[model samples]
Target: MSTQIVILAAGMGSRLGRSLPKSLTELSDGRTIMQQQFDNIHQAFGKDAKVTIVVGYKLEYIIDAFPEASFVYNEQYDQTNTSKSLMRALRASSSGGVLWMNGDVVFDPVALERAAKVVARDQSFVSVNTAKVSDEEVKYTTDAEGYIRELSKTVKGGLGEAVGINYVSSRDKAALVRQLARVDDQDYFERGIELAIEQNGLLVEPIDISDLYAVEVDFAEDLERANLLFS
Candidate 1:
């Protein structure tokens, strides 16, 4: 099964307060977040894997940064969240299932490669989870078999943290995007995932990545922590 990579780069870094897009924000090495993410996925998936980026909030920065990849703009990005951005991008570009992921997190390329290997066989979506929890990590609730049950960053209790990387196959990609598009724009990707599992009976599995720390940049403190962790 062929896999494409869709990097969701639409959100405004309202907290970051940078003129450039959040994805284009520079780290220590002068490599932008968008570039690092793109390189990481391409290195793992190989040159054959098609790369498309969903851009909003300083969309031009993303376009200029990654001239090689296809860019899909989200017109309602300010009003919408990541799930809606994903739906818009995937709906516009039809392909085999994609490695749908956030552009704001720092991840290991090898981990993504492992997901691709697993997703190819089952045609099921695979998400990353961690047993370790921090005050900052997004927690998730899963069943005995590691299927994500619920996701919340602020909820008091849950199973584990969602590491923000997902692998979805082409067969169900369209259906999944279509299902999510029907939801309100503010709903998150995990909410859509929960809906798919509950209403549509989609098989969305979880791959625990507790050992691998995924640094997500949400606030100034997060950015500082990521710089320390990834630098």
Candidate 2:
């Protein structure tokens, strides 16, 4: 099955405190976060797939950096969240499976390969990384078998990190895009997944990407952690 990467890069990123979009933030290696994301995708998918990114908040910066990426502008980016951001990309894609990701999470190429392989089997897989994040970090709960059960806004006890990478089959991908279009309330993309799970009984085939240092730059402190992890 053909696969595509849809990146959510339209958030305000207020925590980063930078004028540039979070995805454009420079890493110690000189490559920006968006660059790393595309590089990793290229390494795993090669020339077989395309990279689609949802741009908002300084959209030009991200667009200029990755000229090849299929840009879908989220006009309501400042008003809404990731769910709306993701919907923009989903509508842009015509057909085939899609690998949806959040711009903040940086991952290794192997982690993506693992996610892709799982999706190859079911074509609807989402990864859960066993990160030791604080209780405030977003939590991803999995079923006993490792399939994603729910994505909780608040963490309870300790939960795994999502790593912001998920794969959806062509049918479900279209359904989800349509689902978001129907929803009157503006929720983030994670909420859309939950809705898919509830309404369509869609299951998430989960792969663990815990061992790698996949960083989510939510705040300035996260930036420090990322530097430590990457450097």
Which candidate has the top score in lDDT?
Answer: 2
lDDT of 1 at 158: 64
Q: Write the per-residue lDDT of candidate 1 for residues 1-231, one digit (tens) a residue.
A: 346778898888788778777878787778877777877877777777778898888888788777898888888889998889888777877656667778888766667767867766746654555556676666766666767666656646766677788866666676678668877788777676767776776667778676665677777777777777666
Could you report the Cα RMSD, in angstroms, for every candidate shown?
2.1, 2.1
* TM match of model 1 to true structure: 0.90
Count steric clashes of candidate 1: 3
TM-scores, all models, native as reference? 0.90, 0.90
lDDT of 2 at 198: 69
Q: Residue 221 CA error for candidate 2 (Å)?
A: 1.9
In model 1, the Cα lDDT at residue 98 comes to 69
